[model samples]
Target: MTNLYRAGDLRTPDALAKVTPEQAGWTYSGMEVFDLAAAESVTRVLDGIEGVLVPLSATDVTVTVDGDRHRLRGRVGVFDAVSDWIYLPLGSTVEISGASGEVALCSSRAEVRHEVAVVAAEDVPVEVRGSGRATRQVTNIATPSSFEGADKINVCEVITPGGNVSSWPPHRHDGIGDCEPVNEEIYYFRMGQDDSSHGHPNGLGMFRVYTVDGSSDETCPIFDGDVYLIPEGYHGPSIALPEYPMYFLNVLAGPLPERTMAFCDDPAHHRIREEWTDEDQDPRLPMTSAESRVS
Candidate 1:
């Protein structure tokens, strides 16, 4: 069974009144959930599963820990600007400090930004793959940073440029297996391809989610600006339409008493792992040092 909540579900009456026009204009259509019965303490595990936080405007933030404060300044881009969207991770405890501006955070375990980058969108390289065309933009955040060690969270941007991300070979990661316990994930989508100089949005893609105890379902057609959730299960190469590419942002987290994704590969595409290599990024990532500084 599907065990996730969309951004719409997390809104409290108090939260709605607090949103501004510009901030309210952005869509909060993704998933958020939590897993409390694992080996670790609930607080540690729940830290990252707080859900995705989407900001509506630029504002100043102050996060206080034991009286020492860390500040964060939020800024949103203008319409038609190179980067149409911006994002911040979840579990970020920012206090409004005092800006007549408004910022909205989701109840998800982590935070995610769209197209907000350290460089200009034009400078970011674009890579054309079997799936479609993708513009890779590097993000600088401190929380769940990469895919190496088990930590508070993991975040990434995946652009299906030429085709679909065929996350084939179904798989699952429960505390019993390689992944840590109570791990949750979020997928925030950009638009799928339209057949032009690019490609066309094709067949239905799916997220086959299941737990080790044997429960699952295939998620429906995931399109642009859509957000999906995976509290636990084998997710995949996002299916790309034969014509165009589909894109998404993936954010993962869990109270890794052990902080790791130690799991058995779905035997089907298991061999696919052997073909992988840590080469330089495929040449198409967008954004360059000069372009990013345009602001």
Candidate 2:
């Protein structure tokens, strides 16, 4: 068996983005999906790691961390908008209930333990990243600028509309060159309904990963609930089909003393950044407005 894993190649449970540390040959990062019906839930306590519970297709959930409780709400399917999340420190037991949909649990193995904190849906910063077809909505939920109190995790959400691209210009956080910090990343993807006349599959997209030295390269087909692991590479230009929207959750961690997402663009394609300087960012940005939620 090769080191790379594909969608169907990795057998998993109802929860997706399933990858083991041994399978990745890495120790600091882990990603998984957790789903429960209304009033149904599960409890977990990872002794040496901090975790982030991100709701994918959800509206409400009650999270109890070591007996402290926080209620989360305002979550919808991937195509709709951003949602709420909960973070738990190491060695702490977590009980999640009233979860109405699927939630992604992205954990990082760490020794530092912080208190439990809840990030509400409204507080999440939504920005339009890239321009033109490369345009997409970014919900900065757990990045350094968004949340703290975690030892080794930096998470963000990206939504690439159909016929557009995100992760463009091919960048990498694998090494320190260009002052970029090295980090391993995992991408969990979801696609909206396909409205093509050809009767295409719903929830499908494209992803490319390659080493700068040309040591290896891969561009694979991805679908809803599929996962791609980036141990080291310049990964980019994740493109959705012509008629649907693509959503992906990014989880990153590394050996650096402080957690930060730093990456260098491929020299060959870096000039494109300059070309888009004068262009307007896509008009479809800020995908969700305050109107979606009523007081």
Give me the displacement of residue 45 in model 2, in angstroms. Answer: 0.9
Candidate number of the best TM-score? 2
Candidate 2 residue-wise lDDT at 89: 87
**What stretches of model 1 exceed 4 Å from their correct place?**
4-151, 166-171, 177-182, 192-205, 242-244, 261-263, 276-295
Residue 242 CA displacement from its true place in model 1, Å:
4.6
The sequence of per-residue lDDT tens digits that candidate 2 reaches over residues 1-295 is 1234554565565443466566788878887776677337777787788899887776777778888888877456665556878888888998877646777788888878888888777788888877777778888878888888899988888877677889999999887455468788888777765432111246678888888778888887777667788888789879887777677888998889899987888889999888887778877665553224111
**TM-score, per-candidate, Cα-based:** 0.50, 0.90
Tell me how many clashing residue pairs each candidate has: 51, 3
